[model samples]
Target chain A: DVKVTQSSRYLVKRTGEKVFLECVQDMDHENMFWYRQDPGLGLRLIYFSYDVKMKEKGDIPEGYSVSREKKERFSLILESASTNQTSMYLCASSFEGYEQYFGPGTRLTVT
Target chain B: QQPVQSPQAVILREGEDAVINCSSSKALYSVHWYRQKHGEAPIFLMILLKGGEQKGHDKISASFNEKKQQSSLYLTASQLSYSGTYFCGTGVMEYGNKLVFGAGTILRVKS
Candidate 1:
């Protein structure tokens, strides 16, 4: 089975603090994505990388950046944590455009 | 653009059927379905491609309408384990493989 591992299951950060959320996929998938899920807002894409060292901004990419140093690893960084930025963060990888296997997700709270 | 989902939430009994719809303004190359249980990651259900394919796995099925630019997920005889939030992720051909998911529909199945 393919496994997508998230670095943290839960996180609490103070305002203005920098935060990092890590995601690693065991399968050699070429595409990785980062999304933030909010109540009623659904899952909004933040950033995605099609290949190593290649990244693209999604709908809501402000104050957020991504790093994909390796094909199996993708990271989401909050430049400065804010209350509005707190939500359930999910990571996903896919073989092509078909189905995406997601991580367990990290619930982050900013105060 | 993010696809719109109808019937934000639904409650059904075991063995009942339900339909979840996702419509997008832009043309879609593919539509992906995923179910996420409370406090868990979204699991891929099915994917519909541009050829207007209808995909199904087990009792869950989905159809993509290329002309309407919409997709619908059909859950027949839903089980207790089927209770969760269902999301549709749309991929436009011009956008590469990055997907924008719809506002999810929360389903509650009772015995």
Candidate 2:
């Protein structure tokens, strides 16, 4: 079975604080992705990593960055947390060109 | 560009039928369907390639039309378990590495 785990189920951060959301996948997939989901807007990709230390921006990458220091872990960084950044963040992993398996998701609230 | 989904939201009774549509403005090589329950990860339902046939799960089925760059998901005899947000991911031939998703269609099934 494929297992993807996120570091936190809920998080609250103050304005301008730095926030990090971690994700780990046990399937050894080569692709990892970070997406933020909002009501009505659905899930929008933030960043994706194809290989360790390799990252690419997705449609809504502003104000967000990602890290993939190891194959099993991928992190999403919010350099300056703002109220507008509050949303449900999801981490997903998949084999090359295959279906993705997602983590439970981290709901971040910026105050 | 992100794909477009129709009937932004739908409410149905048990044993009812519904159809959710996803249309893409860009050429697509593949399309994926997923269902995400409240606060949980999205689960992969089916994937339809450019020339692949329709895919189904029990009473739920999906068809992809390469020429029209669209896909439709059919849910028959809807059950309570079918209530959730449905998203369709689109993959273009130009860039096979990423999948662009639609806004999502929310389905609410009542007893």
Top of the candidates by TM-score = 1
List candidate 1 stretches off by more than 4 Å: B54-56
lDDT of candidate 2 over A18-109, digit per residue (tens): 99999999988989999999988888899989999999999999999999999999999999999999999999999986788999999999
What is candidate 1's fraction of native contacts? Answer: 0.92
**Candidate 2 ranges with C-alpha deviation above 4 Å:** B53-58
Overlapping backbone residue pairs in candidate 2 total 0
CAPRI quality of model 1: high
Name the 10 consecutive residues with the lowest summed lDDT in model 1 chain A: A92-101
Per-residue accuracy of model 1 over A1-111 as CA lDDT, tens digit each: 999999999999999999999999999999999999999999999998999999999999999999999899999999999999989999999987768999999999999
Q: What clash pairs does model 1 have?
A: none
Best by lDDT: 1
lDDT value, candidate 1, whole model? 0.93
Calculate each model's fnat, 2 decimals.
0.92, 0.79
- Write down the TM-score for model 2: 0.96
